[model samples]
Target: MLKKSVTFVKGIGEEKAKDLHNLGIYSIQDLLEYFPFRYEDYRPKDITEIKHEERVTIQGTIQSESVLRFYGKKKSKISTRVLVGNVLLTAVFFNQHYLKTKLVIGSKVTLTGKWDQHRLSITVNECKFGIGEQNSSYEPVYSVGGKITVKGLKKMINSAMEQYGNQIKEILPPYYLQKYKLIERKDALYKLHYPLNFEDAKKARRRMVYEEFLLFQLKMQAIRKFHRENSGGASINYDKENVTLFLERLPFSLTSAQQRVVDEILKDMATPYRMNRLLQGDVGSGKTVVAAICLYAAVTARFQGALMVPTEILAEQHYHSLKALLEPVGITSELLTGSIKGKKRKELLTRLESGELNIIIGTHALIQDEVQFHKLGLVITDEQHRFGVEQRRTLRNKGLNPDVLFMTATPIPRTLAISIFGDMDVSTIDEMPAGRKPIETYWAKHQMLERVLSFVEKELMKGRQAYVICPLIEESDKLDVQNAIDVHAQLQHYFRDYKVGLMHGRLHSSEKEEVMQQFSNNEVQILVSTTVVEVGVNVPNATIMVIYDAERFGLSQLHQLRGRVGRGDAQSYCVLLADPKSDVGKERMKIMTETNNGFELSQRDLELRGPGDFFGSKQSGLPEFKIADMIHDYRALEVARNDATHLVSSEEFWENSEYKYLVMYLEEQGVLNGEKMD
Candidate 1:
């Protein structure tokens, strides 16, 4: 009954159902779970207990006739005096002249507004003709969108609950409910929508939040269990001798941190269980080399490999570098991006399917249906967060239980790792390679643009390249284009003796690649681009980074842009050219100058901004919780995770009669993929 369409409810037809669907409510269960964002206190308050600036609902008798006065054009104020017990106060409603005739002298009225104690005035948010019912104290406010009004949504919810509220099954077993002191599912829903007091409302909210978190964590636990027990792992033999020989031939040695991470990856791959891991490190931490070595290991074990990147430029760079390192050892590799087409693409696919190609590196092209691998044993994705979960799964499905390694230079905090990549084993390369100099960072005011440009000129004269980054205006693409163009034009005019290139999201992929190629080859002495350069665009000779309006970006993003340079041995400098007004903005610049550790910056970013702004909430692979917050409600998350881990690890959870409803619920919630967990 809970799975039934919302149209089954009374007063809801096709039109109303469509409106509700706009708010992500399609089933009776969804409608019930549509929790209120806030509540209005309709309970009358004592006049003496009302503090200044407090939102209070008070009942009183009208003492003065409503006076309607016009202030500015199109603005009106309706004022009336009300006497509650022995205290008198003035109620003012802005632009509500229609209430003048209703609020007559000697009539009773109840007003809900913010109290101004000194002036004895109430700025009325709502006014009733008579005293409100004591039982109807709290009114829930839904975040209604489209054509659905809050009042209409409330009525629909009440109707749905009246019809199917009892049918809603409890997700947790009675034992856990008793342990947590949680109310029944039906009662929680009732109190959530229509509470009698603040305590009841709080308890209901806690119960609902816990349920959501538990269900999500259970899903993650089930996934991990399935991976551990399933016979889907790759049968790879780690060629330690070949891997060591390959690493020894490299121009540079691996850092201790990188070596440790490599050991972890090799160990996971050597096992029979499928390896699901994330390799996160700061910029210039040599993640690419680690991936190359692992790919070589898989290839030497007689299994094919594939590396997917977010961009064609990054893919091409990886192909070139990996080919240089692996080709000498007889590891055949090829690049397959969107641009590779027709005869070349056909030949590449043929070779990949025939097991002739040992490794294939590409962009989204690697996930297409036409691409096939002959015994694909290793799958590595660079800048893993850029791709969606489905995209990654699609690529993995093309291979046979391949050992998957996700690489990202954008360091994520451990807390976030558990929330976002909960099922995967995480390894961090916390140390940069030896002899790599830290990027010198400075924050400069907008007025110092000339000085910053002059410094870049000196770097360019020394045969070094520079990057001038432009801020992305979230409001408009036209504005973004104009900003980048204006900056490019300004830089072009300033440095007439050198070549300047421009790049933005508006540019075609081929065009962007061409501009990047020029910059990489030092043909373009100065590259003026947007956040497009924040990712993998390696130019070792480019030592200068100047970002305009730098405060608009988050700390992680600023760190990413700073990572664009400093790839070279020479001293690199990053100049933040911003005129920030807010204290947070100033603090961001100050923090950037203070430290270059991406992990530390990520934690600070989570605190200063929020989880959403950390890496963009949508792309972070975080669940959209109705009531639970990833940061503020972290304690609840931890408890739920622990409980879920315990439950999923026990065989009784899958087979016991007491947990039948929970198992069924896992299916209903799609946490178990509509199947039994076992």
Candidate 2:
């Protein structure tokens, strides 16, 4: 049953299967688990029994029908009225002209619409001919789109349940099920959609949510085990003399927080097991220096280290920064990207192969066929969320179980990070370097654009650089976000004396590199672009950031964009150009203006947008839950975490017969590879 395709399900043919696939139902299990988003209680009522503004289904014969059309400037409305029995029923449809023919005189029909007591009439929302039958029991209302309808989904799900309901094996042990007082798996599946009462429906949902949390915890633990038990790790040479020398040569002293994080990384690297660690920090928190320290350790231990980034601009930024930091101590660094080829590329690859280059930095090109390392001991990926799990794993596979360090500037809440990055040890550098001033932030209306532009002009004229950010690359009719193209043209005219540059993702790699270079070299005083600059480009002279349509972005995004300006010793200012009238929009503005703390803003973002499919992609290695909610299921999550932790800590728990289903589940999800377990 688990292996059966969706088309093989009863009542679902090729055409129906195509519709279901578009709705994300591709297998029998997917269909069976496609729980209803809501339930409908259908009860046929007489015309006199209906209440005002209440929906009801009534069966009667249409005595007369006529289409009444009303014209308007924006659009037109069409109304078709049917006199059935002793009630005057009106079917009002907006722009649905085809309904005129569907309602004919002397037609027996069942109409489901809203009853308006004040008007003494019924407004028809849905109509069907021939006095359609109404189900007396509860019905499931699915989320349908495209060529699929709710009725069709109900029919397919009902048919699927009839064939495979009894075939589902129990997931939880009898002891746990009894302790929790949960219902049977098959019964819960049926009751969730077609319950006798609302109480049973709640219980059914509880069952599903519990299972989701349980499996999620186990999957995370399985990944943790895979890294700890099987991955043959590197051993670091903890030479005190060399460490002291490297520290003394630095331009500035490390902060206490930075020094502590460095100590943690060194200790992890010194261990026999592989170090799977994540370094998180707010923008301008000196994370680069900590990473550079680790790279120095790897090179000193006679191993090659590679740093991969998502964009070419960031790769070049790291290349220059690391070189400036490491070259003074006799470590050679080289960069490999897609644009470099022929003799130059071959020479760099040969250096990497012969261990001549101790540190290598590049974008996706580093994972290509020609790039190889002699003794790749450590791998660091910047903006880890930007790359997929497969890409991260592919880079790790280049060496013999290399230690990995994933770094991110986006500050995720501590609890959420622990849960999400359950497979990796986490270290955070929460302190910014000295002499840096906090960026002054302001939330203003669109009417303040003139003043904002004047201030930006003054900043540019002071021999510093600035960035003008827009939400979209091109003009959009649907959204109100400012377009990068339109803004670029406007900025060029406004700042006629300064060099204005335009940038977006549509540009080529070399084109992007050139534009960024121009900006960094102070050739371009003002850059008008999208969020591409949010992650890359280091222009200390760029002290002012102007964001248009600021409400269109989340708090975390606003913080990251704001981080771009305050990198230098000069005071930076972020102008949020927006007129947010709505409550939600106003809240976003308030949060940004109140504080520049990324961790605090991240917590608020999580509260505003719940953790439902927030990190569902394989890039973050976070799974999507159907029936489970983080806020409502927080208690269940804690319970599952403790149980899963206990089970993973004990070796004998994996051999329990009651946990066979869990093992199968983990294996099916590709979280557990038996051959790699031992």
Candidate 3:
């Protein structure tokens, strides 16, 4: 046992092994485990049967060839022209003089590449002369860097596997393999790189996907079990009469869906076990009203409540809204954020410590060491995606076994929710408020910009306001697209009589708050900004949102941005200005036009782009999956989830050697382990 270093394998020396390290491959096991994303099958097309637009492999003798060269002051171009019977195609290589010496005038060669119909050319990626018989029926295309050629990578991997394949040990047990109908590790690894056929490749892919999902599910289940056993139980009891009284005092009635969600939260809060729950609802779906009832209940029990918002603007909004609703019932509320300073911060801290503040709302400033609550009983986080795991844990640790409720306006699909929030309970609000009308959505090409602007102007004349949104802030010379600041300047030029304010993330917090406040008060007729207004800024007067470069945004983001309007009684409109060249963009816009359902839109989004990039890398905490695709591996995910549940519940498994290996694996990863498994 040489411990399996990649350098020990043939064809992979110190230099090549070091190059592989850049791709996250260090040991022989790592190299053997690196799988290809796809395989290219070459069915061997005859020169006479080869079409110009199709990607095909042709083997034929070169009847004639000539190399042409063009030299300029700073650059030169070289092209090779070959004639195969009546078919003639050009293979152009930029500034590569060595190609002239590689291709001879009359030599037999096999070409594998894309066929271009416009120029009647074959951009040859692989060309082997006199060795046409060595070509495989199918080629494995591994993901490679710029300097790493596909052929070179294949040769290196094949050589390495031949030398060290037998030394790689299987970590999975025999019983587990048979139970899942998985192939052997060695066979799967070999077949994945050089599959006998398409069916074999698919089989290899299935086993690997199952393995990754299995490990992920097991880790999540273990963490959930540990938390269930270790977290101190809450003793606070729920009062339905108090909740009913508060609901009765509300100006509007709650929907049946809202009532169902309220019941779920009440049941969880009343239990002795700590509540780790997620409240996901569509935009303007009355989630805040339900949360208000819970907060009131918590305060009525003489316990403190804490609300954490993702942004300062949202924190201020929640503070005012909660104060308005709770103050009428004689409950006090306080606001704390990074902006609150000097004596004001000290005063809030004093009130928080003395239990004078029943409910406190703030940003990350609430998690500071100086801030303390007298008896924090309930913790509610708005836009839970914006906060990390440690930030959430810090807030939870402030109180003694406080019930946690995580809220998000983005409605996640049930399948994705199960994967991401397996450790917490989920409650979704499927209904909107009674009187709110759905915003009319339309998509237009860039040529209709004037029409959209005229519509905004018409809305402004009616004593209402509008919002113009751009994906970027400042205009970049490199990108040929509109920016928010430039758009704001343009709007000021056009609508000189009306007040126009600009806001972006790069602006100072005070400036953003001022512009938002101005917009709320109708001082600014039109506000131009970025996605900073996506969360909690409520301006019921603004009835129109004209989004430029709409193709650059995802469906969920577009939906969230559109949600900024239609909050008032006035009919609102969302105009999507996109480029006509994008088919996917048009398809996404069509989804917006067909339905106003956030949950349905989210499901379609998950299907279109998958879950990894749904929130644009800022929020999605999906792990780096080597073989498993969260979108395509649904069946495997189900199997792995069932297997994890069964394994965790079995008493015999916890005492067995297999369980010891799993524990060691988790401990090495620095994860928590408790005797709940024992």
Candidate 4:
């Protein structure tokens, strides 16, 4: 049997264990549990159905053949003309003189390779003389590293299974297995790697995907349950009059959608239980204002509020904006960041400890040891996905069961939202503030650059700023396209009289902030940049956004870039420059031109690109599934989710032995016990 620890294995040493750690494999349990992403079936092909240029294997008799040598210093090519019955076929080998000795007159051989349709020939990669019909059969393709081949990997895995396969303990109870019709763990693992047929492989895959998602959801739900039971409820008093007075001082009225979301937040905070909510909004939908109102409520109840942002610039922006608004209401707000030093930092830390500061805004620096809150009741985080789970937990530790309100500008599809944020209650601001116009979007070929420039010049004449976005900050050796620097130069040459600002990732944070501030203050007429402006940089005056090589970006990213404009009352436009020859590119451009609804666009994006590519498997923090597709397998997901909910809700199973086994399995996966039930 494979031991619980990997060090007991034969080949793995301490140093090799570290290398496996990089791959998230630290124990023998981990290695045995690691599953393949996909399985390929290599069934034998019939010779009659094989067309020219098709990959196939054929057994045939080799007829008379001769080697023709060209008179030159260059390497000679060998040609063998083989006759199969009445049909004649030719095989050519380049710079391979050894092949001439392998094939003789009147010999039978089996060749496996792709055929060349133009020359009516087959290029052989694997060929053997006098091979039997027993060798012609199906094969399995496996993912392997540089040191391993498909056959070698299969051999090693099979050997390991022979010794430890049946030893795996089942974490799921027999009753639950029967209810879900899941196969045994050992059989599923073996069939998933090497199946008897395609149907068996698919069955194994279904069971594995269901098990992965079920375990993940159960762990999350258990953590939520623990948190709710241990963390005592907050006692914050509600005052609608205070909130009303604060809103009256605002420049504009809140939309109905925004008001509904604010109400949701207020209700959650007033309850005895600590609130764990997620506020999702579109680019221009006033989510920050809602967060500000929540902070106001907390401060009025004699409690402090903390707003944590992902970036330094965003934190500074929120600090200034909130200070300007709350100062008039006699509420003190301070900014704490790494940039503050000496006596000034010490003063802020002292104020935070004494509860003198009602609202504090900063980046991750707010979680420092010296920063203490006297009565922190509300914790709001912007762009919550940018911060890691442990980092957010650390910040929450600064308060006494503080309520958390996470805000995200990126609109997630409903299914994905449920999968990623299962522990938090979700609220969305679906409407934009009044006076924001829908951006006019269009797709054009590269030849229409002059027209696009002319439109930009017209927008500039109207006293509106414009943004030109390129895909890359610097030039890439592999792709032949214009970089941000090159594009900036080209735009400068075209509009020599117009003031243009350039921004890219290569610039320092301070430099980027300066350029963005210039654009926001109307100091620059045209801003040439990369996708660095996708988040947190708000320029309401910029009404035009032209993205170069728009085909290189995903639909969601393109939607965000388009959102940079149309933030003001002025009519805005987004021009997508792409090659018309690409059908997928054209379809993506069409989706952008159709609507400005982020939720709808997200659903369409999930359909166009599979969920893994849509969310980017590496960045999304979603569990990898071998068979369950988030888009195509929605039905299966729903069924499995319901099954997990039912299993966890049964009170009898809470302290049962089987439930304990499930909890142990989750702990083995690094999900520790926590308070809160999802």
* Candidate 2 lDDT, 1-678, residue by residue in tens: 756898777788898888888878899989988888876555557767777889776677666665657577545455555565677766565665666776677777777777777775566666667764654335667889998888778788888888887787788878778978989888888898678666778899999988888888887777887767777687877565787799889999998889998999999998878989989999988888888899998888898999999988788889989999999989999888887889999999999999898999999898887788999989999998888777888898898888889999999876667667766788988777887788899987988899999999888778989998999999888987789999999888888999999888899878888998899998999999888888956889999999999988878888999999988878999999988878877998998999988888887877776654234343444456777766657778777776777776777667988888887888888876643311
Q: Tens-digit lDDT track for model 4 on 185-271? A: 778887777676777777777777777777767766655555555667696786789888999998889999999999999998987
* Span of ten consecutive residues with least summed lDDT in model 4: 131-140
Clashes of each: 0, 0, 0, 9
Give lDDT tens digits, candidate 1, residues 301-336.
Answer: 999999999999999999999999899999999999
What's the TM-score of each model vs. the native? 0.83, 0.77, 0.86, 0.79
Residues 626-666 of candidate 3 have per-residue lDDT tens digits of 88887777677877877877876677656788567565656
lDDT of each: 0.87, 0.82, 0.81, 0.79
Pairs that collide, model 3: none
Question: Which segments of model 4 are wrong by more than 4 Å?
Answer: 4-42, 47-112, 115-138, 168-170, 174-180, 233-274, 311-357, 362-372, 387-394, 420-436, 471-481, 505-511, 578-595, 599-642, 658-660, 670-678
Worst lDDT 10-window in candidate 3: 669-678
Could you give the candidate ranking by TM-score, starting with the highest?
Answer: 3, 1, 4, 2
Worst 10 residues of 2 by lDDT: 612-621
After superposition on all CA atoms, what RMSD does each candidate show versus the true structure? Answer: 4.5, 6.1, 4.1, 5.1
Q: Could you tell me how far off, in angstroms, the CA of residue 337 lies in candidate 3 after the best superposition?
A: 4.0
| lDDT assessment of candidate 3 | 0.81
User: For model 3, what is the error of residue 56's alpha carbon versus the real structure, in angstroms, after optimal superposition?
Assistant: 1.7
**C-alpha lDDT of residue 269 in model 1:** 94
For residue 404, model 3's alpha carbon misses the true position, in angstroms, by 2.3
